[model samples]
Target: MNYFELDTPALLIDKEIMMDNLHSMQNYANQYNVQLRPHTKTHKMPKLARLQEELGSAGITVAKVGEAEVMANNGLKNIFIANEIVGKSKVERIRKLAETIDISFGIDNTYQVNQIEEVFEGAEKRAQVLVEIEVGEQRSGIIEENDFRTLLEAVKACKNVEFIGVFSHDGHSYKAQNIDECKELYLESVNRTLHFAKLAEEMGLKPKVVSIGSTPPFMLNFEIPNGVTEIRPGTYIFMDSSQANVIGTYDRCAATVLTTIISKPTKERVITDVGAKGITAQTRSIGHTATKGLGRIKEFDDVHIHGVFDEHAIIYNESFSNQVTIGDKVRIIPNHICPVCNLYEKAYLISEGEVVEEIAVDCRAKLQ
Candidate 1:
């Protein structure tokens, strides 16, 4: 059956293109001798996470404890929640997960260390954790050397918590002016993360995994420094409009929103069935990853969604409106694939225009 026959506003993944993306990133990791622990927050589907593990991802990286549990329940044992695990309830959940699988989380302060120490009081194994270094992203990471040492000291003094290694997210690379600036910023961020790893070594806590990632830096194929042990690129599996801008091509973009043209409101105005609730209203607004409009019209060249309402995507392309009728379907390559994925309940896996599988968004609302 034709994909246009499926309900309006469905997510679709091109199987061949998606597989190529998965293999390409894994090959990059293998070439650099680093583990590709892909961030599963991209798709949030256990099936895709398992496929990544089979395709050579060392483990899986998730954003929340709920996602970790979903992946772990699906038999993805080696898991890393790449965000600070706060509160007694979340800490206790980690304690429960630790009992059966190899699980670890991010920490930037001793307060988190102390909390984990209390939660894993009589657990079978010590709570494993990694300290996050603020490597220019200006996010939730320890920026100062003294702060890094202080957090490590707390981990060292802890009776149950075990410091695994240092990690950092160079998200700033997404806004780099060009590929050259992207490479320069990437190296600096890697060096800063490596510096923290060295500090961990000096403090007698030999880090087992020194991880650093953000898709933009890796997409450029900039050389991964020696000290880094793993790369956790999330959106590489399903290239989006923003990432395609960094590379100057959408050939690798496998995910798209399959929507039907609901109405031709005016001579130059077209509306699709999907909107802010579907493709989202996010724009890169900066450097190499900067995108045009809300979403790129996948079937038409130089066409984009002018805007989106709660349930309608506004299009101002007279040429595009002339090309399709009111019921004709079109695909929109989103600016950011991560959040766009969370909105759909399932994705139609297409192979040469035929729906082969229905991949559920298993962790759709696993925000906790």
Candidate 2:
């Protein structure tokens, strides 16, 4: 079916561009001699996860147990929960999944280690875990080297837990003022991660897997220090306006939200069917090229979505109003693609500006 025939505010993915993005990331990982474990939280589609693994990714990384379960049910045997897996229910679920697949998760505290130990006790398999070190994001990760060492000791005591290695998400790279700053942050994070890995090895806990994740930093040709095993980058698969701005190119972005002009409230105001609920209100906040709206009109480069109600996106450019009329369909490049994908139930795979097929966003809202 043609994309124009679909309902308003539909999610559209350019198939050729998407494949190029995927292959480009895989090639980058290959050149660096690092395993590319593309995080599936961006697309949340098991079909795409399978495609990634087939394209030479070592495994897939997910944010939640529900997403992991979805991919596992669809035959993805190697999965990693990039985020720290807490709660007894979720720990039990991960332990069960470890029985069939090589499942690993992040641990930043002794409480989580104890919970995992309790869940996997007497089990035939142990849950492989990576100690998360906080490099700069100030998010959930072990900050002090001594704290990490203590956590590792406790993990070694757990019979059902296997120490995999160390991991860190250099998410602060998104806030970089320039490419040089991004590179600096990436290198700093990697250095800290390597330091922790060395400490673990010195304590007789040799880590086989040293992972680092962040799309912005990974895109740069930052040197991957020796012993860094895997790199998890999710947004590289289908970049949006934000990532494009970071890399200074929109040519590689493969995702867009297809919307239609529904109303011309005023000469300077045009409303589309998509709004915060569909395209999201996320905006870029770094440097002089910060995006001004929820999304940018792809066909009209100067037009920007100034505001969004629950059901409509308001475009305030008079030039756009003169160019577009009611019922005219337009494609918008969302500021962020990950959340946009989660907001939609399905996405159209477009090739050569034509809709080739529609794929379900099967893992949408699987936040449990």
Candidate 3:
């Protein structure tokens, strides 16, 4: 089947480009001697996760337990929940999953450790976890050395949980003003992560894995620190307009929303059957290469998505107006791929303009 025959606002992935992006990262990891554990949150499809594994990924990282369950049920055994899982119900779910597959999660606070310990008391295998150090994301991670020590000590006290290692996400690097700034942030984040790992060893906790994540910094530095064991960059698999700004190109972006032009309201106005609900309104505001509007038109370089209603993307450019007409189909590279993937139930894997496969987003809406 041809991609043109698919429904409007369909999610399309160029299989060749997708494979290239996957292998490029995998090869980079090998060159750096670090394990590549690409986060599945960007695609949220088991098929892509399997492809990553085939390309030498050590494992897959997910943002939620439901995603892990989806991958695990589909035979992807090695999984890591990159975010911290709290509450008895979630902890109980993790415990059950650990019994069947190699499962681990992130932790930043002591209370969460208590809940995990309480949940896996009678399980045959203890829960494996990584301490999330705040390496400039200013998000959910231990920022203070004292707090890190306290959390590590709590993990030792819990018989049901094991302190495996440390991890950090240099998300702030996305806001870097230039390549030099990006490199500085990358080194700082990695150094901080290594420092915590050293502290873990000094405190008598054998740090088995030291992981760092974030596509902007990972791609900018082009090298993972020597002591870092794993790299988890999700957006690298499906490059987006925002990521394109950071890395300086959209040549590696494999995902695009195939939309049909439904209206030509005026000489300077055109409308397509994709909007915030499809490509999303995410835009890039940082870096010299940031997108001008909501998303970039794959065929028309100067045309941009000026606005998006629930189901219609508004285009306002004389070149786009002159070139495109009603019923004509166009491909739009979204500003952000992660949330856009979540907007679709399935993605059409395309090769040479033909539909090669239909991949069900098994983890779609699995937010529990």
Model 3 lDDT tens row, 1-368: 99999989899999998888887888888989999999999999999899899889999999999999999999999999999998899999999999999999999999999999889999999999999999897799999999999999999888899999999998888887888888888899999999999999999996889999989866665667678999999998889888887777788889999999998888989999998999878876776336788888988776789999999999998777898778899999888899899989999999999999999988887887
Top-lDDT structure, candidate number:
1
Give candidate 1 misplaced runs (Cα > 4 Å).
none
Candidate 3 structure, TM-score to reference = 0.98
Model 1: per-residue Cα lDDT over 77-158, one tens digit each: 9999999999999999999999999999999988888889998998899999999888888889998899998888888888
Clashes of each: 0, 0, 0
Cα RMSD, each candidate: 0.7, 1.2, 1.1
Which residue pairs in candidate 3 collide?
Answer: none
Query: Model 3, stretches more than 4 Å misplaced?
Result: none
Using all chains and alpha carbons, the TM-scores for the candidates as numbered come to 0.99, 0.98, 0.98
lDDT of each: 0.93, 0.89, 0.89
lDDT of 2 by residue, 105-157 (tens): 99999999899889888889888999999999989999988898899989888
